[model samples]
Target: MARIAFILLCHKNPDAIIRQAEQLTAAGDCIAVHFDASADAADYNAILNGLQDNPNVTFAKKRVKCGWGEWSLVQATLNAVEAAVEAFPHASHFYMVSGDCMPIKSAGFAHQFLDAHDCDFIESYDFFDSNWIKTGFREERLIYRHFFNERTQKRRFYWGLALQQRLGLRRKIPEDLQIMIGSQWWCLRRRTIEALLDFVQERRDVMRFFQRTWIPDETFFQTLVRHLVPGREIECRTLTFLMFTDYGMPVTFYNDHYDLLLGQDALFARKISVEASQLHERLGGLYASDQMEFEISNEGRTLFQFLTGRGRVGRRFAQRFWEQETTLGRNRELMIIACKKWHVAKRLVAGIRDHTNVPAVEYLFNEEDAALPDLGGIETTLEKRSRHRRALMRMIFDHFESDRLIICLDPSSLDLMSDFFADRATVRLLEISCSFDDDYLAGHARRVGLAGPQTGADTMARLLPTIRHDMVYERDMMRDADFPNMTRISDTGSVDANAHAIAQFLGVSLETGKTLAETPHLFVD
Candidate 1:
């Protein structure tokens, strides 16, 4: 059992921190809380109380004040790391997380991943060329004074103190200094942590130099580690999925994005807010298991089995095929539907399944050509179409139940389908259109007395209107004509030819068409 420790730096949101601690505990991982002294101790105690006799949790003694762009935040983190090392000396790895950070994977899997890599997971991107630091400096100088100074009710001197450091007025650092950014949240091997600590301790001059520098959080550890262990076994990637707002503040993850986060293969995510309580609740299940399932089948099989049992076996099978196609490149038990021609869908599915690594193709026949002979005894015609469409949709949805979905459709189709099923499930939508230059289709509707050409004058015009007006008839006709060709309706040409065009338009790789398979519903309505 490789031991892992979660070091969380918390402020006022003790409730969130406590919830995170509980999640870590459920994963059989140890938690260490480092409360900034500036925050209320009573609140910290309340947080500790929530943990309630959890043997895996420990409250750190040292308290440090942290300010953005100040060295204190990094200092506080280093202090906590040192304390965690001493307390959980046998821990295989130490993960530095914020109160806002949440684990996306089980601690067991995290431990195994670290054990295998023997490398630290810290997203180290070249920030030197990025406008981030420069922009931060400008915002502090101008925006900080314009907005925050008045809101915080701070004196002129205090505001100046805050802004001066952020604006780089307090430090004479070089303009061309190589800036590197890793996630403030990271998982480090014990050896990496010790080496960092050693470097900080021995190089007191370097530490002192950085202490007075601007944006130390972005610079301190990155500069030191790059120098200490140049080209060492440090992953330039962080195991955290973090979303940033336009203002650069971290935003809470939406519940709908849960599947995306899971598919990203990252270990943790950061900046979860109080509003994301529902998201936290959902993720709790992923990390709740005592032992992490590393094998792909172990993770996928359970979900697949459940979906298959729900009378969604066909869709589940498709999804399984997509996964296999993406991972193994062997297409065995898969199906393809070409809107253009039956023979094309059939031959492509058959050829891929038989010759390539793809699974057997279960060609979905159009209602007109080969009505579902299986449902011959069905009574009502309307009921039959509904049932058939539902069955077809179910198969598509099921295939994507455990994998990422990449929907390929025109803007009109995307608008219709997304609006129709907005509340049904949590799936990511990526809208694509083959042509951006031509407004011929837009003008054709106007000529047919359906609607005028879409103009940028109104925001509503920019987006496809959800309301089904008479204009939608023209749009529908256009869609029907285009969708079939797009899906390789012809048997004479290759499915790969048209499929490749669609995939290219969507900016995705044509690897077993897994993205298309996973994304079941294409809007043509």
Candidate 2:
């Protein structure tokens, strides 16, 4: 069995910290806590009273007043690690976690996994090579000295930054170390930790340089570990499950996400919501045996896809419709089937799918779930209001095997449709006119209730003009003269006939049993 020493950095929530520490110690793992010196006296006393009986729990003698994006946080961690190393001399590894973090898996499983790897699991990536930092200043965080806390004293932080820029003053980093950055949460071998402590003790200039550096907690250990440990011994990935939003804010978990967290490959989850007592109760004492083979779940992938669709790119695309509509490129093989009534358009899409082998779906921008693969996250009212149509289109195009896609358009989405097809030079738009009776129109009008009562002809007049089409299947004789690219469906009334017409329009022969791959003209020219 691998003896692990957990270094916990706690601030508030005494009960929660007690539970976490007790759970870890219960599993034969020792814990050393560094409660923030700035925290309430009552909370700190409560923690002491709660865990005084546990022999495995130890507290750091030297406490620091920690602040966000400050060197104090890293110093606090170092104090706790030193206390842990001295207390538990048999400890093989040291895992650092925040107060809000909880283990999703059993301690036995973690020990097993760590013993198998035998290397440090910490996310260390090149500071400049990848787009690792999301919101704040990246290279500037190191080169310039930041005296004010960016979160608390925003005005002072900016003023200090401007003053530095005016004076052309820059801090020189230690030549021996390459500045690497990653998640502050990490698990490292005892030897690596000892080497890091020794390196920090010897290098007084490094301490002085990082003391003024911005957010040194993230870069301090990450940069130093690379310098001390060999590249082969470092895994360059954290075992903790940490995810951030587009604004670089951490994602907090609640009670409902129990299954999602349980299914993840990560041993620990960070920054849990304080209100999640039920989540704490469930995962608090839960431990899996070594005999149980853990199968990695798809929940992580699903959650990742969900978060990706709501990320910065998705939000930007969503907001674009308000300022100016973006013209979609016809570089990919895409087809649009528009009808006044969604049911008729859905039926046409069904016929297309039945006859041809091309990928087809109904309502790519429906208010409900999108008919594309893995788009369940785009269903909220804010998501719909943001008008993430282009993002949806991109996902639809990317989901299928090839770049070809056939989508049915709801009449409600005509404005979005028009925006996309405004500069349509290559995309094939097949518009099918549907006849809406008086009853249907009145029901729809009652449901909508804009300014006045609407009739069937009034509805048709409003919806028909926005559709851009290369070909028209005039099912309703009332609008036969409305389209210049008219192909009368009167000649082909049957589903099979209409299917054949669509297949021929797409350059696929139904009689010869040709697939989309065999038809080169549709995709190429």
How accurate locally, in lDDT, is each candidate?
0.52, 0.70
lDDT for predicted candidate 2 compared with the true structure? 0.70
* Ten contiguous residues with the weakest lDDT in model 2: 310-319
Clash count, one per candidate? 18, 0
Give the per-residue lDDT digits (tens) of candidate 2, residues 231-329: 999998888886776566788889977766765678889768889988877777664333345545424543444335421221111235443444344
Candidate 1 per-residue C-alpha lDDT over 250-336 given as tens digits, one digit per residue, 9 for 90 to 100: 656666545545544577876556686678887776787655643221122222232233321222112222222222112211122
Off by over 4 Å in 1: 50-52, 130-134, 138-179, 290-525
Alpha-carbon RMSD of each model: 19.8, 13.6
What would the TM-score be for candidate 2 when compared with the true structure?
0.68
Residues forming the 10-long window of minimal summed lDDT in candidate 1: 327-336
